[model samples]
Target: MGGAALAAGGLLLPGTAQAAPRLTTPSPVALDLPTVPAPRSERTAGSALRPFGRHLAFGADPSQQVVVSWQVPDAVTAPFVRIGVQPGDFGAPVAAEVRTLVSKLSWQKPVEDQPPVKPTTVTQYYLHAQLDQLIPDTTYYYVVGHQGYDPAGQHTRLGDVASFRTAPAPGRGAGFTFTAFGDQGIGYNAAATGHLIAGLDPAFHLHMGDLSYANAGGSGKTSDAYDARLWDSFFVQNDPVASRTPWMPAIGNHEMEPWYGSDGYGGMRARFTTPDNAWSQSTGIYSWRYQNVGLISLDGNDVCYNTPANLDYTKGKQKKWLESRLAALRADSGIDFIVVYLHQCTYSTCHDNGAELGAQQDWAPLFDKYQVDLVLSGHNHVYERTDPIRAGKATRKVASGDTVNPVKDGTTYVVAGGGGGGLYSFPVSDTYLGHETGNDKPVPMVVSERGGHEQTVKVTWSRVRYTGYCLVAVDVTPGAAGKPARMEVRSLTEDGTAVDRVTVQRG
Candidate 1:
């Protein structure tokens, strides 16, 4: 098989016989920024060059393509990936592309009251190998190596190799499970959650954004608190799970580093390559399909009224694209469920950051119109699930273990923000598995308004709220013709305790 290059229009072009594996060109934003060498202290000493932050992501079509990404501590002669159908038998090496990112020194403080910070310059090298034409429902083993090191050589170790299974073909009716969470930072809790998800053996994981929290301040403004080294810790912590699972991500406000680009997505684009099925070449907003399920990732910052720094950046283009994608998915005969995940919440009872009016006003209507099965978000650090909602009200109260039919009822919104971050409190009483405290009063929470303002509002749709570190796993059971498909959405704590569960069925 021959490798190909990704064209500017997101098409694959045949590579010449003599041409090495082609790489995607650097983004215009990255090309315009200046790059500098890392400080002596930050440079890799006399150690062998090794890869870290190894992770996988599905391409436009998960059934036939995947993108393997990793980072090197220092500049290497030639970095490549050796892949094969069997373990320890990687045939030929596929050349990898390097994306270099630079974070210059900053003396300004994120907050006026903070003390001046020391200056530091950091540079990172991210490598990616886009593997296409893979067999569906097959596992492929791979290892990363450079000129001085070879995994298949005599010095290979068991830990040097990793494998990933591609999604089944469309209409395959293959039952699969995937996990979702957000607001995961680098910490003990976060690491525990990663191990828990890996234990569940999910085919893929949806990171609802606020990934590394390198930028402690989520204001999306230029902050001196930003530390590029934090990303190193984050990837290392999650490498155990991310190396084998497709860790798909959504863009959150904390990901908005003003120093990166106009919309603050230059770093993200360089770090991870997502599906290119979005409008206007947006990296954060894209859609993909696996078996009988259709999944869409959105950039909530563009429509987040709470964080107005990048608000309306898309000029309503994202919403338009979303509607079209939803319509297409709803029209597809093979797609039994449509799930959307983003950073901010359309409805949440977290007092810190409740409902995002921007998203509710712009995208919720489309979810209702298309009858989306489930919506997931992670802005507030807690777990909350709403009743089947339509037109800003709960059509029916859906408790845990209850079944929901989006076609007849409405979409269900879930807030699984408790992904290892500090837990947040809700205006309503806590209610979940093993711990249930009923709340009869209307929960008074803050609603995001335009221009970075907040308004107090009382609502009764707040059903389940659990303040703890947790993640959500969704198991999809495909249905045959004339039968209804089922999806079991379960919320589990870092210790693997089920906090909440709900079944979604579609006819």
Candidate 2:
């Protein structure tokens, strides 16, 4: 294999004798940026430490394990979490580990002769507590605090406590709901979406990627200004919903912070703890099974063409792991559905970012082979869905409210990018649940390819397109002895207006 192919984790062909090249992570970039302290407003007050940006994630097993993560503005002593089955009676204090991130700054000159960029250094402290051996299908109340600041203290208020429920045990045949979206940044719309998700009361949430746009530039190049504090605002904004629901996430191009690590995932690694059930060395790639549904989070940067900074960093291990995971999930009769989520679009018509051909070439075939039920993506800043597709072509047009059977038809792709980022436009007119712009002519759009080539192609699979801020809520009902499993997917705007709906079923 060629050097670029080998570097991107391509497998060697049979009868090839050349040894695989050794892969090494690039050393962190040193840009000599200035160091700054946490603003006075963010620091803790005299002995009263406050934790923000609280979120949750299921471990390898959702029924018996959960990882609780939260952030403190500044350094503190003896940080820990207290949890119990009752609201006011936490059993014992669970010590938490602190992950500290020192973020350096970089500036981008969009044009020549631009003035020098002034950047700020941001240091963040994140604490995590892993709770295991928990009862299934039960709600647990919890509070996060450090020395001299216990939320369970008699003087503390009721609002300080948050709760989360564990998923049902294996083969429980219990039904549940979950919400998903991507490209969510900190803003009024982002906060509104969070509230809408909270109202839905999903069992958990899937964040497709581009969580906090601290680095405004989506390009993997380190030339953009990096303001790490934007993460603080993002976490605080989503705290209401994330603190209560497991906020699972995939990594996107914007997540590639150049100054932190070789692939710019050091910050994300320190802030979130996801399931460690996939390739051991890969970040933002993991899988978990909750009742009858199997969820997989993939790192699109590994196979993206538009943003190739961390392209193929996995060395083919991620794809190999994905195939293996899919096979195992399919083998198990208990798993009735498989949903894969990533940042870049495998099939989208958004003129701004278009579709990622690398993903379409590398992963879509595996998706087809495994018969994945649903594929969710972001990075386009709009809501778009494709007809049930196989081999890059639409098998059939599935309108809003239509039901599809992946077992007979093909996998469905949804671009739920309207998760609070500014909207992007489609080459054609808008069409959604309540409104339809009767403009369905075939339009040419760009397809991002490896080596930075843009290919123009005309596509007809762009079925439902909504140019507004929205979130996707899915209700999963497990199949019984004589019945089939079903998932009802709904796209709702920021104000809880339904714009699109579809159903997927498997026998």
Candidate 3:
């Protein structure tokens, strides 16, 4: 909010890899960073067009842990990530799992064509192995490759070593830095946006949803491929931004599926893995603690597509989990504050689009009841914020000197759906209608093109028919002069400059 309007936090601190293209016994996959033309529509362009990479990202392991992953191309043979502290911090090296190339681009494959089937292009996924419990506020080094046993124990790794800093503990003088941007899937200025975002150089990044146009069709692999490739190649692949910074993502309608994949989210599941067993839950919805912040990531896919077999998700399970998670967090003495992220904004007219009424009805009460601080979401493919709403009433936005919001356990919601999927061209002309049922922001409802059964027919949870992608960044600092620093949320334009911003503080 400092740019548009912001409060302050404690202090600030800051912040890729590569692989092979082909496959052979000893590292055959060659990986190239695709500089896609427009709307980055393909994993590998047939022959002429440029292969694109867009959604580059990184995620944290609680506070000390930072993991990085990205896509590899078909030309490079064996691929892996390099590790170190800074540019030359390569004193000691750490490596993560070595990934093979993705043979079949499509999710539906004959049992006969598994693994390397339809090997037209190779999309390798790599991680920064074992970035385990690190010291808060410390930076690490890395490069792109692995000490693989390539052909008779030959080793291979393509990129150079890079550096990244861990999140600072709240008790550590100033703290950490994070940023959030939603609704960026247009592919229009995605590459530029990634570069723009990369310049800010925070500790970690957060995404709202709608990562790719392919996901709009709801193919599980398509969506995940977008995540891996875009993240590494365009967003983080050869880039150091994500190689060292952590990434936190919220489930979006595009990533949900009964529509494609062997089960659901085959791509998402394969592309990124979270600590599901930690809280005993599957899917993207889970929670982790970062410094003094308790962050919760939710599986909004279930919010739109509710079912029991999806029992892993659904209303009943989430409600129970929410209560239990909050209870534990509140009970703990170490936690300083709480924040939550998901694909749906609690206060929006599009609630009906994604059939989000169920989610809102179920979660809003819990947020209000628990005083969950802040909520981040994407769906409108635009950015909007509330001035601290409690039970549908406007409270004041938190500012300097304010100790806490007077409202009991109140929260502020932000809609940030823009991560290169697509861009929207709608204005908040009227109140949103359909399945959504919450109104907690200034008028001029932020909305997008109404996706329909066709959209849903192709993807899972068609309830909220729409398109676009998004990401978020957070900066955590100790309170200023005894007051908590403001929490800011913003939306970036295709060029990567802030379009709007809002600051959140205790009432």
Q: Tens-digit lDDT track for model 2 on 112-133?
A: 2323443344557778888999
What TM-score does structure 2 among the candidates reach?
Answer: 0.88
Q: In candidate 1, list every pair of residues with a backbone clash.
A: none
After TM-score superposition, what is the CA distance of residue 236 in candidate 1 from its true location, in Å? 0.7
Better of 1 and 3 by lDDT: 1
Candidate 2 global lDDT: 0.82
lDDT tens per residue, model 1, 1-507: 012232322212222111222223343446545555344323433136678899899987998999999987766656789988999888788988766666665622322232233445466767788889999889999998876678877887568899999888887746989999999999899999999988999999999999998888879887437776778888889888999999999998889877776777667776888887775458689999988889999999988887888888988889989999999999998888999999999998898888899888999999999999999999999999988989988898888889999999899999999998788897656998667676557888688888777898888778788999999999999886677799999999999899899999975
Instruction: Rate residue 428 of model 3 by lDDT.
Output: 30
Candidate 3: segments with Cα more than 4 A from true spot: 1-62, 71-82, 89-95, 98-128, 147-159, 186-188, 219-240, 257-263, 277-281, 305-315, 350-355, 393-409, 425-474, 490-501
Which residue pairs of candidate 2 clash? 9-315, 9-316, 108-223, 433-499
Clashes of each: 0, 4, 118
Ranking by TM-score: 1, 2, 3
| TM-score, one value per model | 0.89, 0.88, 0.67
Question: Best candidate, TM-score-wise?
Answer: 1
Error of 3 at 204 (Å): 1.1
